[model samples]
Target: GAGVSQSPRYKVAKRGQDVALRCDPISGHVSLFWYQQALGQGPEFLTYFQNEAQLDKSGLPSDRFFAERPEGSVSTLKIQRTQQEDSAVYLCASSLDGPLREQFFGPGTRLTVL
Candidate 1:
């Protein structure tokens, strides 16, 4: 089975540009999560999805951040207006549907907002 994957492993965007990041979770794993990690900080949870339903998005930093899982599978995270402060590694992880299970993470999409 395929593991999680992210596209354009690295990106450089000018300030105010919009960028979209993609994630594909392991087949049949029903829980998916998106996170952001600053240079020295641990990954911070951005949003969580159970199946196709977005259950929590409290961690989205601003209105510019959005995520979706339209088919109960592959997910996307979009940043509407990139800023220098938004430069960070965005990660996606998935696991068996529920809390407390160990999560398998993808190699993150590294975004540089210049």
Candidate 2:
């Protein structure tokens, strides 16, 4: 895809189930980010990866949440033991350099944990 692309645009999971969300960023983009957006709130940063190195993950809410960009092009966000609170829109974005530059966002994957 020419832009950031996320799979499973919508997901419904049972409580305590594990889920993995995939993100394919724009070709050659160096910066990738993961964000979580609640029903009425804006997306909140979860992590940031520059190339294949994860430079920042302080925004991740808990140890159950993990994100990685192994090869710098594809990224994945995994949520273990999904809780009701984990339900939200998981967004993926990519920029040419860093967050300071304009980011291209993908259609977020909406997760609903019941």
Candidate 3:
């Protein structure tokens, strides 16, 4: 794709269900990041991957959240045992090298836990 693209622009999950959000970044981007955004707040960083290596996951809220970039291109963010509090927009972004570079953002997957 020309830019970052995310799957399932809108997702509805029942409580306790698990959801996986996918992201396909620009062809050669080396940095991928996952973020969670609540209705009225800014996006919060969840995790970061640099060319298939998970470099930082300190921002993840709990054990239920997991993100990976196996080949440094496509990435997935999984949320386990979804709860009402987990309802938010999950965003994915990619940069050329590191966090310092400009990042391209995907449309984001909005997950609603019912």
Task: Please report, in order, the local distance difference test score of every candidate based on alpha carbons.
Answer: 0.94, 0.96, 0.94
Clashing pairs in 3: none
Question: What's the CA RMSD for each of the models?
Answer: 0.7, 0.8, 0.8
Q: Which stretches of candidate 1 lie over 4 Å from their true place?
A: none
| lDDT by residue for model 2 (3-111), tens | 8899989999999999999999999999999999999999999999999999999999999999988888899999999999999999999999999999999999999
lDDT by residue (44-112, candidate 3, tens digit) is 999999999999999999999988888778999999999999999999999999999998999999999
Top-scoring candidate (lDDT): 2
lDDT of 1 at 110: 99
TM-score of 1: 0.97
Error of 2 at 107 (Å): 0.3
lDDT tens string, model 1, 71-92? 9889999999899999999999
User: Whose TM-score is higher: candidate 1's or candidate 2's?
Assistant: 2
List of clashing residue pairs for candidate 1? none
* Candidate 3 Cα errors over 4 Å, as ranges: none
